[model samples]
Target: MVNATQVSFFTLSAYFDTGVFKYLYFIIIVSLYIVIICANLLLIVVICMNRSLHEPMYLFLVSLFVNELYGSTGLFPFLLVQILSDIHTVSAPFCFLQIYCVFAYAAIQFHNLSILSYDRYLAICYPLQYNTRMTSNKVSVLIALIWLFPFLAIAVLISLSVPLQLCGNIINTIYCDNYSIVKLACSDTRVNNIYGLIYTCLIVFGPLSLILYTYMKILKVCFSGSKQTRQKAVRTCTPHLASLINFSFGCLFQILQSRFDMSSVPMMLRNILSLYFLTCQPIFNPLMYGLQMSKIRSLCKSIIFGKTLTDA
Candidate 1:
């Protein structure tokens, strides 16, 4: 039996022989990575350069855009290499690193969205006190915690998996996963399993609960307020809602595909579904927010065109 320390590499069993199509696959992935980097970078730059956008909402958006870059960078380059290589194997340490990046990315995304919902809640429900509540210092602290908590949590997770005595090292999926590694362990995994459940609740359910509560409060204010207030609520909340829903579905698809028996599903569809959250969400968020938010849209136009177009 190969133990964890003895295992030097893991073969990704999901990748098949694509023959000549491998080059085509490589080109498509490269294009996607370039787009993800450029779009997210543009948004981050736009938010940081404009003083009018130094408020809590745009600051949170900067964090969001930065994460899109972080998450995509972690996956895309590795994926591009794998697509072109005949042997789909990764070094053990690199595999663990990828797991850390993927898990931390997910945790940060949920926390960021939750913080955004709360920001919107304050802005719409208590416009008079929104500034007082979501001050610059507070926003900085929240963004810090948003990133710090996830890194620490996923650190603990990776630590638990790193020292295990592994019976096998072949991960059935295209990328390394903590649970997949845990399942390969020859040692006891009760603690790992238990901690994973707690981590899941903290990373997933906890933020979702906060998001739900904030939206409910926002909805109450919208119902009782004036037409102008209602319009404001709709205009501001629409992008956030769309982003939350889009990311939530992507996560849902990924989780279901990972945990459930997906053998009946076609290989191409399974591969696409597994990669949906990582690939699509990075691109989806910037486009969704960029076009829908008038301020961002106008600023992007000004930057790209050298003059602001009239807001229609």
Candidate 2:
């Protein structure tokens, strides 16, 4: 009979273990994280200060920014420290925390994007009813649900993970992930895997389907109007569409990666791609949605130059 010790030890050698590339990757990722933080922070400030942006749409945007900020901070800072340090080992408790944080953020992001889609759906489909349906009270409730629902799910999952025994110390990817962490467990992980897959499908695919359906209905509504109205509607939806596409693809890829076995894939290649997806979205989100918007651009410019003008 084979005991736990009889099981083969899985060694996770560092990919991009070289000094130059490691530092380069560190600097670039850190720089991107800083930009994401600043951009999102500025967006919240501008939205709050400018009464013009006090609508439900901008309120949702601000909530998304805040969520992204917390999400990126949870993973990137620890990864940055690891990249710089000689020691790369993460303890069990810390590892669990990492998994909890990643899942919590991912769930919140999915739910928030879904709410945004529903917002668009109402605005386009119901038109006259949007203002009444998406009131401040309703929006506040939705936002609260987006944050709270994920926490409950994560708490249950982490509790399940607590009893599992870990055999290894090294996590192959830059940051701790559910799959990688489960692979360390001494017991059978089939239950965890099954639950994870089910959760991923519901959290990722379910929202993705809703977004697609909402957009399709929105398009139908847009095209029913005059050519100019159709054009304007498309223009308005373009930025959200870009973000939806990026987010959907990123999330789907992550879910696929999590569900399938990745032993055949080169660890370095996996690390690089994972880092790209994880960091790039937060950086790109603000650029695509907030910075590119005419109102946000004007607000940023005004804030920067207004003080100087006043002083002079």
Candidate 3:
């Protein structure tokens, strides 16, 4: 019965009364949030403070890690608050804000990964020319573009969504989702849908295409080159490839759960699946990169434990 303009808050029906179990949930989520923050921040610090880690690859990683922190912060605190509250309601403006944050986070992640792939492509395929192509200034600009493009793109999406006349105020999920809000609109949404499609092509498929192309090129180089070259490619590219695959799969899960009929599935499992990308990706990237990248692992050990192990 509520109009979109008049709707002050939206009900999130995903949450249920878990009684004392809420406390357990709260502890678990809070612990997760803390871990995400600390892990990402630790890597960021390790990258920034060490001059040895100031190369293009590590710089790109800093951007990626910072994004993990940004994306997780956008979701975890709000989720924590909602978990403890009896009524799961979020203000309209705040909901849209969350949508913006979440969307931008996703966009930035894809773009960042794309650029990282490009960096790898340069490093592996054209090692002699990498310094010339991926200069510090260029790296700075690429970093700027990754962050700027997503924030601006999501802003337009929010602007489009905010003016819609919604038929309902209830969001079925725990978090504010742009597609869900657009679906609630009683007003004409053709423009929104069109723009959304365009944004997806640009933000999602565009980067994915670039990533695929770069990897194929990298693979070609590895096959044609020496064993040392193959080892080098594997050493540098494995973590990035793993991170991309993991995040992409997580995104796929979220998309399937959101766009399709999942009512037959258990609600608890649905909630976990919905949150998988946001929760897992943040922690996943740091661990994958931290352990897999020898330089970072050695540097971390040196910083944490008073023993400076040489990079293997």
Q: Provide the lowest-lDDT 10-residue window in model 1.
A: 303-312
How accurate locally, in lDDT, is each candidate? 0.90, 0.75, 0.91
Clashing pairs in 2: none
Q: Write model 1 residue lDDT over 1-312, tens digit each, in one string.
A: 677889999999889999999999999999999999999998998888888778899899999989989999889999999998999999999999999999899899999999999999999999999889998899999999999999999999999999999998788789888888888988999989898999999999999999999999998998899999899988888888888888888889778877778889988888887888899889998998899888888899888988743423
User: Candidate 3 lDDT (Cα, whole model)?
Assistant: 0.91
Give TM per candidate: 0.97, 0.87, 0.97
In candidate 1, stretches whose alpha carbon ends up further than 4 angstroms from where it belongs are 308-312
Steric overlap count per candidate = 0, 0, 0
Taking all chains together, the TM-score of candidate 3 against the true structure is: 0.97
Of 2 and 3, the candidate ahead on TM-score is 3
Instruction: Give the C-alpha miss distance for residue 292 in model 1, angstroms.
Output: 1.0
Q: Candidate 3: where is the Cα deviation over 4 Å?
A: 307-312
Shift in Å, residue 105, candidate 1: 0.8
Using lDDT, rank the candidates from best to worst: 3, 1, 2
Q: What pairs collide in candidate 1? A: none
Where is the poorest 10-residue window by lDDT in model 3?
303-312
How do the residues 1-312 of candidate 3 rate in per-residue lDDT, one tens digit apiece?
446779899999989999999999999999999999999998998888888888999999999999999999899999999999998999999999899889888899999999999999999999899899999899999999999988988999899999899888888898999888888888899999999999989999999999999999999999999999999999989999898988998889788876788899999998998898899999999999999998898888887887644433
